[model samples]
Target chain A: MRALVLLRAFSRAKAHTLLFSSHCARRHCHAPAKRERAKGPRILGPDLPDIWRSPPLDSTHPPPPLIDANQEINPTIIDGNSIAEEIRSRTAEEVHQMKDAVKKIPGLAVILVGQRRDSQTYVRYKIKACHEVGIRSLTAELPEDCTEDEVVDSVSRFNEDPSVHGILVQLPLPQHMNEERILGAISLEKDVDGFHPLNVGNLAMRGREPLFIPCAARACIELLTRTGIELMGKHVAVIGRSKVVGLPTTLLLQRHHATVSSVHAFTKNPQDITRQADIVISAAGVANLVRGSWLKRGAVVIDVGTNPVEDPSSEHGYHLTGDVCFKEAVKVASAITPVPGGVGPVTIAMLLSNTLDSAKQIYGLNC
Target chain B: MRALVLLRAFSRAKAHTLLFSSHCARRHCHAPAKRERAKGPRILGPDLPDIWRSPPLDSTHPPPPLIDANQEINPTIIDGNSIAEEIRSRTAEEVHQMKDAVKKIPGLAVILVGQRRDSQTYVRYKIKACHEVGIRSLTAELPEDCTEDEVVDSVSRFNEDPSVHGILVQLPLPQHMNEERILGAISLEKDVDGFHPLNVGNLAMRGREPLFIPCAARACIELLTRTGIELMGKHVAVIGRSKVVGLPTTLLLQRHHATVSSVHAFTKNPQDITRQADIVISAAGVANLVRGSWLKRGAVVIDVGTNPVEDPSSEHGYHLTGDVCFKEAVKVASAITPVPGGVGPVTIAMLLSNTLDSAKQIYGLNC
Candidate 1:
């Protein structure tokens, strides 16, 4: 399984190289103009690849240009999509083995309350990933006006189900509902989201192992580790302290022996702090929050922000953007993760991986 | 109760001023000679007050000089003993009121499993503080070679005891014992030490409050807040990542909206990071780990280290030292806490506070 994953990763890297060559071909046409702009303060928006952009039909904003045309330096793009794919493939193989050995497959149960488009899309992606890995997926779709007890009932039912190895309650339950109370109802063993206080506490302490880590935080570390970015003894500036990502990422980074500086809204002169870091992880959910000046030269950038910016050209009428000013950061940073294909896909892969681990624990099987 | 505590604090502050004046008179005797040493790198040992030092009976190390001879600045000496006394007085008044309003009092049960001198001293202090605050105290002294189940049995008994509002398992439990398993057995409600993962997890997350925060971390925050030092938006360098003090202190600082940089042994240039902070909290346990150059002038210093250094003149054959080089820091920092008299006393006070809060919660009392 390890060899298979490595083989997939190697092929993916080669594919990434070929794709970059095509981007280089497109960049040559505007190389002269780009070099002039690169001399001054970079005011350019993210130069996304054509493949990542949609057709301009009744578009409000003009389509962003292709890759930065700077010939002097091209950063090694940390391909999170490729890494997530490798993880999913490994999880699939393990699920297949587990099923053959015990005639038992991993099961994930999701309770998504309300009809929030973003939440629905997230749940759909999760279910699809579960099915791809041969994991049984169960979902309870509650009305927008559902009571707190209704959500608890779904969680309780899933907790009692022997077949359900993982339970996730999609976040941002209606403002009227008590999110913490509902989440607290989930059984510790089946909390694949790893939102339980016990799990989080375990993660924070040294010599203690959390049963599961939150998917996005796990994704951040996985991307760095798999990409051979050394964390130990390195200075990391984690921007934002949201419970789901920033806070957990800080705890996990400390566990890995990285000296972390947590930057938030209350931070004064955040740029100076970020510039001092060996690595900068921006999860602030603010568009273009981290500019070129905010990072040190050769710093590794992990963009976890998935802010939605209006784009009528896209089918969803919006495009996902990252916290980093991509065009500006790519010039200063040695390596960087792109918005839509970066931490987002890897986060989903982590969810599947966690679900498989949960099932394996219950079945007493080791992959 | 509040007024009484304030009055006691005012008296204590006045007494501290009187004590410092006599030290100033002593400093005048060696003013000319000490002035020469201050111009250099300031390689002086802690200038402890005569009251804090024991008589030099079989003295090996020379008696250290008095406060820094530099007359240009005199930092506010954050007398934690005075602050802790204020808290204890408040708790005592509240406990007294509780006894009047109801016939019950807060109870704290401590389980000491080993003969480690430090643990024993800490447990003794806790018991003494509880008694001083009018809270009931119980203790179980187990042998060093006691079985894990034996310790758990004690915890279980306390967990079920209606009179026991708080349970504390004195740390560094024998090498053979599984500490996490034993601590996990304690009832969450009675976990006054707040070592439980749930409490830690809650503390790490925004919009969530832990039932109890670790005592030393609480002491760090209380010392700062009571001193009128604003935390919101301030840059704080937390040296060390120990679960008991450093890690929790970092989390709590973040919750208070402070941008915190966690510097550990792995950090390449901890001094540079510490120098950049408005506040520096040293809990690294290394004696004088933070030097004068590591601090910014006018920065607030909270030294939580209580490291024991050999001192033949002292009765105990050792003396408590802080992580900061006091004589050096005193010249630079705007405010600083001393070693033995600083965080140590307040930690015990917080444990008492937590026990009182736990009992109040259980009894459904507002106070």
Candidate 2:
């Protein structure tokens, strides 16, 4: 087992080096080719290299190389982890400055109800993240069968607490509890999750600004903008219509002056629509739902889906996967974000950013 | 001049008759033809009819007929005026019931600033509409140079007036006035225009309901549903992103399970996108921006634009026209709404409907 782990790590490192070198070469030698190729059919031809046409590998085997040596094109890998770290470091600096100037730091209060292991793990990550940025954190844990009033009371306490600059009620609250009622109890000023209808409405409207934007949606845009992708006048196809990610992302894209098309389960010929977009964002939550054939050549792909599929070789007997088949997309896209290290890290960074913003507003510090 | 007036009126009546008879015949004879043609290219062939090929007419000439004798297809004209009358009559009956049961009728307060002739005309029409439906109306006329505080005070007064179930602040308030601040001051319950961020947010979210939907957006949906058009899974292209019509309409279409593409000023190749939609809704506020070639052969068209263009032959020296070229679209679309009598009338009726609903909610009468 130890030898196998070493082999897998070595293979991954080798794959990264190959992809990076190829990506660099393509940028220098094929800039004009990329644009000309984008106008033609993106369907892979039968002459695909043996390595590119290989079938999916099992967890027992070492992961295949991300780029085939003989392949003519390879996408630029968007390193979300590095970007997230950059944001966190910047936020930490701000927090340190606030502490030095005013002897205060941002505070985030999280209310977690029920014992779902996933929810507990998520809360733990959030708390740890707060500590990393020098922000104070508090948690309210309730029994699985807690009453709606109990949850509301916890929110009320946080709402009234001046130290709690941001209040987040962990989602999927016990089935018996009314999610809307409890969420609505959070003060609008401290709604760091940006789930409040007023915040959403303001975000959707032109010339209006929301106090806070939803984290995942903000993460998607941050990834693109940070990568120097200009959104203005660009055509974007967002696959999914969930309130948490897809809907807000579409609205945000429109705010950036991108022509947006929302494709969901009911959409007929979704691939055809997606193939025409210059940017494709998939939040459908269906593992490997989007294929290379669904994308336009040289398109920028942002996969927000994070589904856990069973994998016995893993410690937890499962592994996280995204909506797109990464193997197929990397060959066709101009730039692509990988699953585990992509949107998830950036989303957490946005949460920290929002909390910091709330603290600044409360403390009357423009910075 | 009198003879020309009679000639124009007679010509219009004859055109309506021709369109109606042809539409009915095509519905019976070309039901299958419509479905088959939808898959083929929609461009007009070289053998186009002479009447359809005529250039734009001057005000002096009699308006051209809507259908040619040899034309193979004619769309079913959506009669917005008649549909609006039906809704208005229904609202009047509900108002009568409320008066009989509780001795109360819905009251609307309009705050009009400045002396813009168009704004004054719109306010006059609204007041007349309220009276037609047995709604009590009040107006506060302010000068063009009124202070922001004066506008806020007007909104505050209406907000406090329990008798006023709905409050409408006429749009395009003086350049010096802040529109957002004044509109935000209106009580949420009395925001009949549904411009409140909270209402818009709720409308955009799944499993959430807004206190009121914007009138024009609601009107667009009413026209489609009442005309027996199925929105579920349909591909809809919404041209424009205005807060009043386009934005809300696009949001509403998503709520109805339609896959929506928002085609805006920044959209590349807007015609290509519009041509692929199963339903095309133009609210760009640009007169005659959409031509016949921009439509699918059997697509449903909802023209929400109401742009006023100079017409010396008219009493007002200007006539209201929609974003679509009516003469060209009639031959391509499966169903269409005409300008002047299309979404304009229906939008006002929706306002009345929203006001009536507000009164019912406040009066504790669900019916």
The global Cα lDDT (0 to 1) of model 2 is: 0.75
* Residue ranges of candidate 1 with Cα displaced over 4 Å: A1-72, B1-72
Model 1 interface DockQ: 0.20
Residue A363, model 2, lDDT? 69
The lDDT of model 1 is 0.76
In angstroms, how far off is A287's CA in candidate 2? Answer: 0.5
TM-score of chain B alone in model 2: 0.80
Best by TM-score: 2
lDDT of 2 by residue, B207-259 (tens): 45566789898888888888888887788999988778888899888878788
Root-mean-square deviation (CA) per prediction:
19.5, 20.2
- For each candidate, the DockQ is 0.20, 0.19
Residue B330 lDDT (model 1): 94
